[model samples]
Structure formats: C-alpha cells, structure tokens
Target chain A: MKSWIEKQKYIIDFTLSSLLRRKVKNIGLLILYALIVFILASVMFFTHAIKKEASLVLRESPEMIVQKVVAGRHDLMPLRYRDEILKIRGVQAVEGRLWGYYFDPVFGANYTLLVPPATTATEQAETEPMRTVVTENEHRHGPEEQAMPLVGAETIGAGNIVIGNGIARVRNAGKGEFILFRTHAGEGMPLRIKDTLSSASELVSSDLILMTEPDFRRFFGIPENYVTDLAVSVRNPEELSTIAAKITRLFPDSRPIIRDEILRTYDSIFNWRGGMMIVILSAAVLAFVIFAWDKASGLSAGERREIGILKAIGWETSDIIRMKFWEGAVISLTAFLAGVILAYIHVFFTHSLVFEPALKGWSTLYPQFKLMPFVSAEQLTTLFFLTVVPYTVSTIVPAWRAATIDPDAAMRHTGE
Target chain B: MIELFDVRKVFNTGKPSEYSALNGISLNISSNKVTVLTGPSGSGKTTLLSIIGCMSRPTAGRVKLSGREITSLPERFLTDIRRKTFGFIFQQHNLIKGITALENVMLPAYPLGERHGPLKERAMHLLDRLDLSRKAHSRIEWLSGGEAQRVGIVRALINDPSVIIADEPTSNLDTKLSYRFLEIVETFKKDGKTVLITSHDPLVYQASVVDEVVRLRDGRLEGEAP
Candidate 1:
C-alpha cells in the first residue's frame, strides 16, 4: 500500500506539470467543464431545496381538505359540510377555510388573500357544537400549496391585513400603508397593511395577504353559511383516508384532497423538472464526452514521443495509465468541485437569479428566498460517474495504447 | 552477459506490408564492455538494440541476460526486466519537455516506488557526475542540446541498471558533445556496466573505449571487428 501511494504521488506530480505545459488549452477545458457542472448542479440544488420547502409548507397543513365539486367544477363549499366531516369516526376536527385571489390591474399580479383560521384544531373540535356558518368564494390558492408560513397570522383585525414581501415590494406598500381592495360589489374597501411576511417564507408567501375573517368575507362579499373548503384534522393520521372517504360519501359533490396526494403532486412536479433538467444536461454531457474524445484521440507527435520515452525509461503500461488517470482526475475533479461550490452559492446565497424564472413555472411574482442546501452522496456520486469517470477513461485508454507499443517504434514513428 | 541467439523481428506479419526489421542474427555482448552496432539507415540497428535491451520481444529467438532466458517472458515480466536490468538512451534525448532536468532524471525511479529523497539524491548525484548539477532545475526545453542529453543519460542510470542501451547517441550532437557522451560511456564500462550502442557515426564506433564493432546491412550481420 505504501509503495502504491508513493507511485501515485510521483505520477500525480508529473501529471500536474504535464497539464501546466498546455495552460491555455487545459484552462479552457476546465472553464467549460465547470460551467456545465455549475448549471447542472444549480438546477438540481434548486429543485431539491424548493421541494423540501414545499414539503415543510405541507407539513403545516391539516391532514385532509374537503372541497365541494359542483358539476365537476370546484365551488364554494357550504359550512354544513365541515360539521358533517367532523362527525366522521376518527375525525378530530374540521374547519372551513376562506381564501381567494385579488388581481391588481396596475401590477398585473394576483394576490392570494386568505383569512387565517380563528381557532386551533382542538379548540374548533371542542366548540364544534356551538359554531356558526359562512358563505364564500372558491379560488385557486392551494392552502397547502403555497410554501407560505403565516407568522402571527390570527392577530390581524378586521380592517388590517398582513401582506407578503412580494406584495409589499410590488405595491410599494409597507406596514401602516393602506391597500385599497376593489370589492366584488365594485366598491373600494381599504385595508391597512399591519405587517409584511418575513423573507424566510418568501417562496410561497410572495403574493399572499392574510386578512381577518370579517374583512375577507366583506371584501369578497361572501355571504354567511359558506366557505372555500373544509380543513379536516384527524386524531389518527392513518384514518385520514377513512375520514376523507366518509366526507366524500356524506357529500357526494365534495372532493377530498389528502396531504399525501398533495405532497406526491408537489414531489412529482419537482422530480419531473429534475428529470427534465437531467435530460437537457445529458446533451451538455454528450458535448463534454466529444470534447474529451477529441483531446484523447488527437495525441500530438510530441505527446506520443513523451509516452515513448516514459515507457523506455522503465514506466510500464500500467504506470502510464495511472499517470494519465491522475492527469484527468486533477483537471476534472477540480472542475467538479469548482462547479458545485459556485452552484451552491448561486442557488442558496444568491437565490439562483439565473434561469430560476423559468424553473418557477409561470409565476408572475418571484420570491427572493434562500434555499437550504440539499446535497446527497448519491447525487455527488452520480455526478462523479457522469463527469469524472469518462475523463479518466478517455485519458488512460489512449495512454495505454501508446505505452504498449515498442519504445523504438514509438520514437521512430514520431520521426516522421 | 547479454546473449541473443537467432533473433528475428517481423513487423506487419501476414499483411501486404509484412517487413522484417531484424533477420535471425545472433550476437553476444560480454559484461563490462562497450559494444557498438554500426549500420546505415534501415539496417535494423535500433530494432536489435530494442530487442536486446528488453524494450521489445523478438518474434523468434532466445535472449538470455546473466544466464536467464527472457525472450518468451510475458509483457508484465518484460517490463520488469526493462526497468531493473537495462537503461536506454534515445537518439533525440527525449526528456519530457515541461519538467526540469532533475525531474527527467527521476522518471525511471518514480515507477519503481523508490523513496523519493534518496532517489532524488541519486539522480542529482548522477547529474553532478555529468557536470549538469547546476542546470538540474532547468526545463528540458531550456537546456542546451548536450545538457538535455546528459539529463537523459542520468535518467537511464537512475534505476542503477546493469546494461545501458543507446540508439544513435551522438547523431544529433556536435563533435564536442559526441566526445563527452563517449566519455560517459567509457565511465560506464570502467564501472563494470554492459553498454550496447547503435550508431553509424564514425566518432561513435571509432571511440577508444569501444571493445567490439558489429556491422549490419539489410537486417543481416555483415561483419564483426574486435
């Protein structure tokens, strides 16, 4: 083992100097290689981190959601459906959630206006027998969908609103600024911005506005006895499907959305995007393979002679191959490390401004939020196999061919 | 002693370009002697040198070094024989271009897994012996032709091989450097090292240290003089 280490040490030393001999060419290859790695790694890190953020948002949601589907279209669910869902066996509590979108014509961005749940699950379950109803409008805001965290959500009063950073930034509004909302009755209802959501939850809260129940109902003109959907919290998580089935059966027009299905939907979107990025990256890798092949196959006469002399001076074919392995490894691994680090900084530190707009998929407002780094050994190994292995092989195979020839013939061949 | 019996090297056999670089020519090189193979171009001098130095395998022949037959050894063993038993000096002094003179000298020892400090000491010592110690850190391309050639010679000696092989050592050197190379060959002979040189240059064959001369033409031996 010591001997092997010693041998590799000297070969690497030689390989480093050999690489330095052609500085411009090798540096160019390194930059191109690193650029490919940077792009691929940035895409991967962003997808993984955003998925994790989405999952965290999902974790905060109720176990199941009961939405009223009328004529195959999502309609405002009646508050009576919440009482029915709460009566299912193993169902702990059910609360009707009111939420809708407010599109500002001036900004051309849709703001998700949600009424924070007034009470906790246990409180709601305890007070279910004495509760009233609500009339509301359904909107596309997946309550479990936005990577939104409502900090001090229920504290806002009827005339006060909590806006997201995106809303605040686009509307140029802040705490104490009044945002004029156009009511469904074509009347302007003024709501003061109590606070802006933290930048930490910017991923989903970018276009979110949290208002009190009375303000939400008054702004959207939702009558009493209706809501957007029913949020079902179950005592036993495994009974979520059972309660969801019971709710759907109790109200045949209602559709139940389980947390797992929501999670899977979110997971598949990111995974599909990740897979798509890999397919696109494969084309870059193919170009890299061709570049490596060009370098390997086009060994100059001087390079051939260098191998010949190395062989003539007691270097075996294995030694030359090992030396070339070091050569390729030094260049490629450096590029890989450089690329990954740059991508990490770009994705997590800089919010991946490059190409992230496309990745977010048609969102008018982009959240400026830092994603925690999501790296795995498996991903790095996949990357190593993708980039480093091919380079090492390309180097060693040609070196082996040169080293196997008779030294005299190798030297004389270069004589021409 | 190095012995070659009826050695033959046929290139491109079974093809239209089938050619024989070495015909069944037998020769023996006594230990501690400088033997020169003198011939015109295409006279099989380098091929025979390559075969005798274990740089290649002869298609047909028995090659024995110090009474051990090695003609049929596998390539792995042949490489060991090449590394341990023989040191070759190429005609063009093919030191790798980017590395220093000392680094080029240390090339052979690198693959041997030798202790680097001692190996470097020995390499530098050999360069000193050739009056190249001052230029040991100069890149191969930066060195004068003769200095680069001397570095090549020290590279051959780095592994402390018993037999030294040189193919047209003085072909690309001026008369002064040619004489200096011959002097280095004489030093090897006096130290009990077998030296096999392939050269047609009169300065190389007519050197005072040469013990024997073998002339070749058309891949066959023409004459031998002692």
Candidate 2:
C-alpha cells in the first residue's frame, strides 16, 4: 500500500509539473471549468440557504391557517368560525388573526400589516398573548428563537407599529418616527414606528408591519367581527390532518393551509428553480463536454510525441494511462475546489449577485440579509462525479490510442 | 545473445499501400559486442532495430533474447522485456521538452517505481560521467544539440541494461560530436554491454570499436561488410 501511494505521489508530482508547463492551454480550460462549477454551485448554495431560512422562520408559525374562500378567492373570515374551530377535537387553540396588505404608493411597495391578539396594560399578566404564541411556537434550538425580540402592549401600543428592517430601510423610518400610508377610505393613516424587527428574521419579515388589532381594523376599514384568517394550533400533531378535514367539512368554502404543506411548497419551489437552472445550464454543460471531448481527442503533436518517447523509453501502456489519468484528475479537482470555494463566498458572503435575482424572484422590497452557508457532502460529491469523471474518461480514449501505437511509427508521424 | 529467425514485418497488409519492411531476415547478435547495421533510409535498418528492441512486434517469425523466444509474448510481458533488457537512443534524441536534463534522464525509471532519491542519484552519476552535471538542472531546450544528445545517452544508460539500441546515433552530430558519441559507445562496449547501432555515416561504420558491420538492401541483409 505504501509503495502504491509513493508511485501515485510521483505521478501526481509529474502531472502537476506537466500542467504548469502548459499553463496557457490548461488555464483557459480551468477558467471555463471553474466558472461553470461556480455558477452551478452558487445556484445550489443559494437555494439551500433559502430553504434553510424558510425552515427556520416557519418553525414558529402556526400549524395551520384557515382562510375563508369566496368564488375561489380568499376573503375575510368571520370571528364566529373561531368558536366552531375551537369545539373540534385535537384543536388546541384557534386565534383570529387580522392581517392585510397595505400598498404604499409613495414607495410603490406593498407591506403586510398584522394585528396580533390584544395586549393591554390592565391585563399585564396575560396581556401579550401574541408574544406567548410566538414564544410557544419558537424552535427549541435555533438562532431565530434567540434572535427575535419579544413584543408586548408597551412595545406596540394602539396606532403604533413594529416595522420590519427592510420596510424601515426603505421608508427611512426609525423608532418614534411615523410611516404614512393610504387607508381604504383614501385618507392618510400615519402609524408611529415603535420598533424594528431583527435583521435575522428579515428574509420572511421583510416589508412586514406588526400593529394592534383595533388600529389594523380601523386602518383597513374591516368590520368589528371580521379577521383575515384563523391561526390554528393542534394538540396532537398526528391528528392534524383529521382536524383539517373536519374544519373543511364544517366550512366548505374555506382552505386550510397546513404548515407541512407550506414546507412542501417551499421545497417544490426550490426544486423547480433548481430544475430550471439545470435545464438552462444543460446547453452550457453540453458545450463544455464537447469542448473537453475535442481537447482530449485532438492530442497535439508535441503531446503525442511525448507519449511516444515515454513508450520508447520502456514505459508501459498502463503507466502512460495512469499518468494521463493523474493529469485529468489534477486539473478537474482543482477546478472543482476553486469553483466551490468561490461559490460559497459568493452565495454566503457576497450575496450571489448573478443568481440572486433569479432565485429570489421579482419583489419590490428585496431582503438585505446574508444567506447562511449550507452545503451537503452529497452536493460536493455530485459535482465531483459530474465534472471529474467525464473529463478523465474523455482523456482515456486519446491516451490509450497514443499509448498503444507503435512507438517508432508514432514518434515519426510528426502528428501534423 | 539476441537471435532472429525468419523475422518478417509487413505494413498496410492487404491494402494498396501494402509494403514489407523486413523480409525473412534471420541474424544473431552476440553479447558484449558493438554491432552496426548500415543501410539507406528505406533499407529496414530502423524496423529491424525496432523489432529487436521490442519497440514493435514482427508480423511473423521468432525473436529470442538469451535463447528465450519472446516473439509471441503478450504486450505486458514484451513491455517488461523492453524495460529490463534494452535501452533505446533514437535518431531524433526524443527528449521530452519542458523538463530538466536530470528529469529527462530519470523519465525511464519512473515506470520502474524506483525511489526518487536513488533515481536522482543514478541519473546525476550518469550525467556526471558524460560531463553534463552542470547542465543537469537546465531544461532540455536550453541545452546544445550535443548536450541534449549526451543527455539522451545518459537517459538510456540510466537503467544499466545489457543491450543499447541506438538508431543513427551520430545523424544529428558534427564530426567532433560524432566521435564523442562513438567514444561513449566504446565505453559501453568496454563495460561488456551489447550495443547495436544503425547508421549510414562511414564514421560510425568504420569505427575501430565496431566488432562487425552488417549491410542491408531492399529489406534484405546483403552481408557483413568486408
């Protein structure tokens, strides 16, 4: 085993020197190879980071959200449905949620306004029910659980709002400042900014506004007994499907968006994005494969002559093939590593400029947050087999052809 | 001892370009002697040398090295015989470019899986004997023609094989370098190595160290030179 390793070491050293000798020729291929890897890896890293971010943010979300549907469109839900939902078995709690999108023509962006359950000073002990809801749903061990700030009646008083970091950045508003938006009555409704959401939750909370229930209802002109949706929590998670079915049967014109379904949707979205990227990149990959094949098949005169000389000097066919394999392995592995590192830096550190717009989709207010770096061993392995194996195999036919020829004839061919 | 019996090599057989390079040639190469084969460009001298060196296989007939027939051996065994038994010096001096003289000399030993320290030591010793130690670190392109050829000679002798097969060893050398090359061949002969050379140059054909001079014409051995 040691002797075999020593032989490989010698071959690798020789291969390195050989590659360095032809830097001008190999560098072009290396750059192209690394660029392709960088592009694909950046896409993978970006999608993986987005998926991770979604999972973290969604961890604390309600298990199910029941929305009333009218003529295939979501409509405001009546507060009486909460009582019906509460009576169902396995239904732990059902809270009426007041949330609606408010369009600010000034910034030409839409911000989500959410009115959490009332929290007043008179009921201090039980005042912050929404804060309890968020804390209860928080992940046992996650950065979001620690990073998110707890809100109460004092933090968000009537007619005041806690704005997301992205919204604050766009409106140039700070704590104790006022953000003016048009109400349903076409009148200006100015809400005082009480606090800003943490940057860590910016991926999901971007362009969000958290306010009191009365303020939200008054601003949107919603009826007193109406809410945007009903957030449902289940006592027994395994019976969630049965509860959802019961709720659906009770209200035929309603849709229950389960947490697991939302997660599956996110997964499918990312997978679809990845699939589209593969389709688009397929042409480039094909071009690259053809380029590799052409480069390998058309061995230059000097290269052929070199192989001939090696054989003439008593090197076996296997030796020549092994040398060629080392050469290909060295080049491909270098390109793969370089590309992956650059992609990691690009996606996690510098916000994947080329791929961010495509992956993030079109949004008026883009999140100003860095993606968490997440790469799996399977991804690295896939890239290795995809790039290195094909390249090394492409070299085999040409190397074998050169190695098996009569050394004298090959040396004299001139390969012009 | 090297012996060939009814060796025949045909090129492009059954094609319009079919041509026989060697025709029923049989000969013996004695051990520890400098034998020269002199012929014109198309007289099959190089082809015969290639077959004898195991660089190629004869289309027909048997070739035996030390009375062991190797004509029908597989390529793997043939490669082993080539590595362990013969050292080749081509007419072009076929030194791989972009490598140092020392590296070129050590190329043949790489496949042998020899340890680098000893391989380098052996190459340096051979280079020193050829007065090329100074140029050992220089790339092949930087060396003079004679220096490169001397490097090639050192490379061939690096393995210390018993047989040295040189094709037109003096073709690229001037009169002074030609004698220098022959002197190296004479040194190999003195070391009891069997040396076979093909050349039309009378300088090599008439060298004092040459034990026998065979002549060939039209792919047939004419006879030993008088």
Candidate 3:
C-alpha cells in the first residue's frame, strides 16, 4: 500500500492528464453532472430560505386573532372590547384590526389593504415616512380553508394605505397614488396608496392592500366601534398559558392566540412544503442513483478492457477506485456550487423564479413577496449530504469491481 | 518461472449450456526462454495465456508463479501479483487512440503509483529505448501499426515484470515488422525474463531463438512439445 501511494502521485497525474486528453467526453460528463447538481441544490436552497423567512415572520406575529367565519368577511369587534380585553391581566394590549380587499374590475386583479398595530411605537411614529406594515391574517383560498396565513396591514391609522409589490405592479399604482377598491359591500372607494409592504409571503402578498384602521372601516362601511379582529399582546410571553386562560375566561367570544400558535401553523405548512421538497429531492436522488448504476453497469467491453489494461500495467485496484471516485466528486461538486450560486441569485435578486410556479394558487394573489436568500449551517449540511453523499456512494460498487479485476484479464479484455 | 499444473477453466458453470475452455492444460515456462503456444482458432491458446497471466481463474487444478500458488487466491490478490510480475501486449496494440505515444506506453504502469517527475522520466526513457522518442507526444491515431506495436512493447516492459505475454504479437505487422518484434522479444529473453508468445504463424515457429513450441488441437496439446 505504501508503494502504491508512492506510485499514486504518478497515477493521479496521469489520470488527470489522460482525462484531459479526452476533453470532449470529460466536458460532456461534466455538463450533465453540473446540471443535475444545479437543480437539486437550487431547489434545496430556495425551499430552506423560504421556510426560514416564513418562520421569522410567523414568530413575530400576533397571538390568537379572531376573524369573521365568512370568506373575505371582516366583522368589526366593537372598540369597547379594547377596555374589556385590556382588563384581562394576561392581555397587555388589545387593538382593533381592519382589513380590506381592493380589486381592479378591469383586469380582475386584487389587492389587500390592512391597518395593523405599531409593533414599536417609533416604527409607526413617522407618519410621513411611508413605511408598509404587515400582520398575519387568515389567507382564504376559497370557501373551505384552514389556517392559511394572509398578510394584512399592522394598523388602520387614517387615510394612509399599504399595498404589495404585485398589487402595485398589476394595478400600475405606486406610492402616492390612489388605489380604487370595491369592497365586499360592493362600493368603489378610492384611497391614496401610502406605502407598499415588502413581504416574504408569496401566497399572500400579491393581492394584499393596506389601509389605516379608520380608512378601512370607513371604506368598507364597517361601524366605527367595530373591527375585524383583536390583536392581543401579552405582558409575559412565557406566561402565555396563564394570560390566555385569563383572556379566555374573561372574553369567551374571543380566542386567545399565542404567537407560537400562529408560528406553529406556519411551521407546519413550511414543514409540509419541506416534506414535499424532500420527496422531490428523494426522487432526484433515486434518479441519480439509478442513472449512476445503469451507467456503471452498462460499461462497454472496450472501456472495461481499458480498465483491465490499466490494472495490468501495475496499477492497483485502489488506484482505479480513487480515479473514479475523484471523477464523481469533480462532477458533483461542480454541479453543487453552480446550483447554489444560481439559487442565491434567484432568491435575492430574482425572487426565486422556480418558486413562483408553486407559489401561485388558483385565485389571484394581491401582492407578491420579495424572498431573501438565507444560508444556515443546518441547510448547508443537508445540502452537502443530499448532493455529495449519494453520488459518492453511487460510484462505489462499480469502482470496487473495476479495481479488483485481475490486471491480466483487464489487459486482455476478459473478466473473471 | 510460470507453471500450470492441470489447469481447468469453465464458462457458465452448472448452466444447461456450460462449456469448458481450458481442459487440464499443463505446461512449465522457464525464465530466459521464448515459448510459443501455437494452435488453430479455438484451441484455447489465448485462454491458457489468460490463466497463466492470472487474468482468469482455473475451475480446478493449480497454477504458480515463482513457486507462489495463485489459482486459489482472490481476484484482487491475483491482480496485485499480475501488476507486479506480469506484462501483456495485445494483438491490436490496444493503445488508447486519443492519447499520445508516450502516454499510451505509460498507461499500464500508471496505476503502480509513481510520482509525476519519475514517471515522466521513466516513460520517456522507455519510449526512447523503443525508438519512439521522436513520436513520443504524437497521438496513437497518427502512429503506424509498427510504431503502435513498439509502443505496446514499451508499455509491457515499463513495470519490469517477470513475464512478457504477447497475444498474436505480429498479426498486424509485415514480415520486417514481425522480425523487429522478435528482436524485441529476444532482448527480453536475454534479460532472463520468461516470454510467452501466442501465435499460429509459421514465421514464429521458425525463429531460432524460440526454445519450445507447444501446439494445441481442440483445447488439448497435440503431442510432446518440439
């Protein structure tokens, strides 16, 4: 083995130079390998980034929010509950929420306008800053829906409204422009677009519009004393159980929601999507394994003879195995890097083009999200395992066989 | 020394259509001698060579190299033995068409694990010795049959193996080229290496340097070797 290693420097040099001699074939293999790596890595990277972003937003979101049962229905909870709910010791703050939907009757495109709370009083203090705010709301696909989250405005301040980029694009309206929305009551009310919310909520953003609480209620003909839901903030997040128990007992009509609950729901969705990604990734991995197996198994007699001759000439089986292992490594690593780079570019700059297809639901989305690329250690580890490990293992058996064959048989184009 | 003691090789064993290629062939090839296994098309001459080369295993019986019984060893172990002790020159030269002459000559010894500097020097030295120094970097597709054969000879000799096995060495060569190949084999014999040449050509039989000629008929020896 020591002697073999001493010889291997020569073998590796020769293998590299020799493979280079067959530039066309090697390049062809390289491109095919790169493509596979790119697709798998991109999907994995993008999904993880989306999942992380969704979880971040979901975690910071309000605890138990109450909305009307009907789709597109925003029933007002009387402002009187502000005091009624505030009296509950666990409930730190009770604020009214107003949500409105805007539709451009011409193109049938829609936007959701919302007015949510000011998480930091300073954040919403600058009335002239024109910042867009987003809050978690029930995203309805149709009549029958569970806990699909939709992005809504944080506060209904006044005439100031916020919309999404997609809504801005589809309606051809930007900040400082009037967006006309026909509410559920079928009234065409116009409000000046103040700020467009930049969100990572792909499914929710495209059709979302935001308005001040007063503007939303006024535009929707909602009573001044009523609101769609209550945003309940607890004094102690860890004391959620005690606080939630107090709120539920005090106000049986309203539900006590913890931020974790909303986060968990979104996490489940992200998990489901992640699970699906795993399924697709597994399929890709299977394809890679099968392709590698078939390719190795289908080695022509001529190629096998080449391996034999290599062995006959004093090349060790281990040397042959190493050469092939390097080949697989080179191909997979190249592909993985390219794929990850492309995905990063797509998420950060292109907003994940591939994800757009999956993000688009049946109904028109009001506003589209700006997905950011995130790289975590766990994700990198996963990507590495998924991409490199399988390819490495895939080449093992064939490499071993090629390595162990009698050099004489190899040289003579015969096998054991 | 290469010795085969009643080596038997079978193909597709236990199947309905099983066949045996080498049937108890026994022979002893001493060092520093040129031995030819001459026979008609399917007399198992190549099969015998393959077994002697440790390219395949015997179904029964034993074969040894320098007194080491190799027939029962695992394939990889046999492969190691072959790498260190055997050299093979195929009928077609079998040079990788895409690589240069020097590279093709260096192919066999590549897996032996030598460093780049020494490997290059050694490969160049062999190519030079084979009178192929000028065409060292030229691709095999551009080399003539005679040149390719010489390269093949260079490849076989690179590892300094104990035995040189050539299968139909001169089939693609003209008479002059054939003599040149013989001269190469003669040099190896002078170096005390055992040389096994498989060919049915009369010219090979007539070579004065050949120590023995074993002819085969139907996978069996025709008579006592002349």
Candidate 4:
C-alpha cells in the first residue's frame, strides 16, 4: 500500500468486483467492444499476411524484366535486345520471354499464356530420368499409370499444353482433354492438355496456360524475332540495379521492372487497402466512443449514491476517479485481447471469408491458399489506441464530475 | 478542543433561492468528552456538524481543531484532515449496496492505501467487538436494521479518528437499539475521544455518557454553545 503498484492493485481489485456487480450491463459493452477490435485486427492480419505471401512468391521470379516501350506503353521486345542485355558486365544470362493475355468471349475471363524455353540436348543428357524411379505415392497408383509419371510441365512438346488448376477448373477440362482456342487469324487450334500445374505454386500460376514456343508464336501471330520481354538474371545480387541501368542506357526505350519494385508495389496495395478499410470502420469506432461517453455521463441513481457513500466515508475525489479508470481499463483490455486472438484465428485459420474478395474479384480465378500468420507490435498498439484510449477518457471525465460534488449533497441530492 | 468562531453558512449563496443555514455561530467542546446537538428540522445542527467535521467549507467563519484554523483550507487538504480527524455516521447509514458488510467497513481506509491484509484484520476486529462477527460477510440488504446501524458505527471508527460525529444515529433504531448505540458512545468517551452527535432522539442526549447538550433554533445556537 505504501507503493504506487500496491495502491493500484486494491483499486483494480475493487474495480473488477464492482464491474461484476453490474455484469449484465458490462458484458453487453464487452461484446460490442471486442467486436470492433476483431474487425480492425482481422483486416490488419490478412493484409500483412497477403503481402508477405506475395513477396515470397515473387522471390522466384526473374531478377529484372526489360520491356520495350512504344509511345510510353509496353510493346513487344525483339530477340536482338537479348544479345545487347547479355553484354552487360554483371548480367549472368538473358533470355527472351513469350507470354501474353487472352480473353475468352464465352467465359468473359482473362488467362495468362506462357512458353517455356526448349531444354537443349546437352541439358537433357545431363539430367536424370524419373521413368526408372517410383515414389512412395506411386505404389497406390495402378501399374499402367505408374509406368511413367505424367510428363513434367516444363518439357511438354508442341500440340500438347499444360494448364493451371484455375484454368482447368473453369474450362471443365482435365488430362487428355483438348481445349480449343481462337488464334489471331480467327482459326480454331485445339491443344491436348498434358497435366494441371501443382497446387503449391497456385497463388501465382492459378490462371496460367503453358505451350511450346513454336505453338505460342504461331498461334499469337508473333514474329520469330520478337518476344514479350527479356528476363534478365544478374550474378551479383547487389549489382542487379547496375546491370539494369546499363540495359536502360543501351536502349532508351526500355523499362526495367525489378523484383523488389514489384514486391513494394504489392506491399503498398495491401497497406492502402487495409488502411482504407479501417478508415471506413472508423465510423463504428466513433459510435462506440459516443456510446461509452453517454453511459458514463448519465450515471444511474444508484451509481451516484455509491460515489456519495465513498466520499462521505472519507474517500477523496481522486480515489473515485481512480476506481472509474480501472473499471474502463479492465473492460477495454479484456475486449482488446479477446478480439486480437479471434482475429488471428479468422485471418490465418479461417482464411478471412469476409475479406476473401480482396484477393480476387467475383469474375477472376480465386487462388485457394491460406495466408501465413502475422502478428506485430504495431498492430496491437494501434488497436489499443483505437479502443482503449477513447473509452477510458470518456469515462474519466464524467466520473470526475460525479465525484467533485459535495458528499452530503451527492448523498441526498438536496444540496444540504 | 474543537472550536468554531462566528461561523456563517449560506446554501447557494447569491442565487435566487439563497438561504442561510447557520448564522454567526461559535462553539467549543473539550478534547475528551461527549457532546450532543439537539434541534428541530432546519435548525442548522447538521450544517454546524458538517462545518466542524471538515466535510465542507464555511461561507464565512473560522473553525479549529486543537487551536488550528482549517476553515479556509482547500478541499484536498480538508479531505485529508477529515479522513484523519473525524468519522461520520449519517442519518441513513449510507452503506453502499452490492458489497459485503466487511467491505463497507474497510471503505474509509482505502484512500490511506493501507495494506489489505492488516486492514482486513483490523476491520474484522472492529466488527467482532461490536458483536457483528457472524454478519461480516453478509450483504448490506441482507442485514437487520440494527445490524446495519452497527455496521455504520464500525465503519466510522475504522479510520481511528480523534473525533466521532454521529448525525441522527438513533433515528431509525428501536429503543433497545438506541440504548445500545449510547452504550457504544459511552465506550468511545472512556477511550479519550471527542464525540459530537446531532439527534432528535432523547435516548441519545439523555444518556449518562453525555457531558453537554447544545440546542439550536432557526439557524442560531442556543444554550451556551454561542
């Protein structure tokens, strides 16, 4: 009792029991307060987790992409630019990429089509074949299907195609099924599906369609000398920017998109979306603050009498204020912790059903993936600021007013 | 001694409904004796007791305990003085509801921030001395009228102040209980504590423990208290 901590302990003890005395009213407030915290925390967790997942998927992408610009817009880059980019001092390797977007009139959705470079005879000769090896899961398969596991997606040949799980799902096509496509010349060309891409990388490859370089070039009417862009890899990661600067200097019409820049763009998008969601939810927070203020300001008759009794029995105004402060603290903190735990479960475990639309719109291929769990000190601090500070301040002002009255007058309300 | 010099108290002063409750009053009582203030309604007995009890300030006047003026002190210092020097038993007992009798008795010392363990022991001792040991854990609404009144008395003494002020302590009590209250006041007087009481009950002022009876009429003191 001689120390400040000892004093607050007794006050907090009284506050808890006093709150229980009015449990019906207090619990109502706790539920509403926790609900607000849950919303704010859930959005924060989902946004951060999605951004982290995006960066992780981007880690495997090219170090830098050099795209040709025509009148400030993206244009096809010629294979001749690959030779110049390869001459950069730090450039490890450079390859022309063939990728484009196709819109299906029937489905009214877009698909990403890509072409994997042909594996050279020397590279194929150096690799081990999977035809002789049988994995543990192969024992469960029938003998015929296990003779050779499905051809790897990267080694598929012409007249054959590998599609992503999302494309396979929406097209209702499976292995050995033929998907017909309309070429640039308005002619129908059907390619046999080899296999659907693995679900592990589904977050990025969900809407992907892969074909051989010859089929891609012939179907899209693209010239053999031109490709979509150039994928550049640098030997020294620190010199990636230097190589990119060299590429830009050699070709003034080139735009270099770095992996880190792409990652930053994803982070900024998620942060902006999460912040906007919170700003919209600020109305609810404001309503709760006003509700708390009203609850404190309009003290019931019994409550006023209790304050009077405390003061009349030698307790001071400061003591009453302290008691009220503890009451607010207990309520707000309990609500805050409960909300944060629930939000974590919702975002990571449940996949945040309410906010799943942000991942993909109604018409797009929705990636079926779980977000990694993320919790930070900044999020908790923001929650405390939004919920605890306002409610506690609202209560103290009214409690002080009730306490500052004369004990006798407060007790009887007669101004005696 | 507890002394008052030319005390004047006006409620809502300068307002349309302003009215004087105490007018130019002065009084003194010895350090270790029991004194009774008896008066009709609106006679200013409670006002005079409140002023001397240090629960409020006087509009104009001076009050002293052991020859020290406290009339003009700030509310904060007055509260400290009140907590250390006086205990009050109101007319209605004023025990906070929803709490046990033991908690109500311990309320006065909470501001002093006394350790709960020793404070609880002291409160139990007081309740036991008043024969309220069995009812210590009972809620306020569950206690009998006499038991609640004694609970108020124990709460008043928990701070162990030098002065005890009981306003209408016997107003809600039966004759037997009123006599019991007088017996408790007799013990307080024997313990060398100053006691002031405002009451309409004859059993209080007529008790053998009382050393003087001061009366009031129409906002003015009578019978040697002036």
Report the alpha-carbon TM-score of model 1 versus the true structure. Answer: 0.92
- Candidate that beats the other on TM-score, 3 or 4, i.e. the better one: 4
Clashing pairs counted in every model = 5, 0, 40, 0
Fnat, model by model in order, equals 0.65, 0.47, 0.65, 0.43
Kindly report which residue stretches of model 3 are placed more than 4 angstroms away from their true locations once superposed: A1-33, A58-60, A63-74, A116-164, A174-190, A193-214, A270-293, A360-370, A384-387, A399-416, B15-26, B224-226
Off by over 4 Å in 1: A119-148, A151-154, A278-282, A296-298, A411-416, B223-226
Q: Residue A302 deviation, candidate 3, in Å?
A: 2.2
Residue A86 in candidate 1, Cα distance off native in Å: 1.6
DockQ-based ranking: 1, 2, 3, 4
The prediction achieving the highest lDDT against the true structure is: 2
Model 1 chain B poorest ten-residue lDDT run: B217-226
Tens digits of per-residue lDDT, candidate 2, A274-305, equal 77887888899888888878876678878988
How much lDDT does candidate 4 score? 0.81
lDDT of each structure? 0.81, 0.83, 0.69, 0.81
| Candidate 4 TM-score, true structure as reference | 0.88
lDDT of 4 by residue, A22-70 (tens): 9888898899889888988898888887786677667767889999999
Residues B147-168, model 1: lDDT tens digits:
8888889988988989998888
Query: What lDDT tens digits, residue by residue, belong to model 3 across residues A1-416?
Result: 86667665665666576567657755765565565665655666666655656665555457656443334444556667666767876666666666656556677765565655542222334453443344343232222332223323444345566666677676677778875656658776777776665443544455666555556666778776667677777777787778767666665665655677776676676667656665766776576567655654455565577777676565567777777777666656776777677767776677656655553233554335555556777866777787676776676667677667655564344211
DockQ of each: 0.62, 0.53, 0.47, 0.47
Task: Please give the ranking of all candidate structures by TM-score, highest first, separated by commas.
Answer: 2, 1, 4, 3
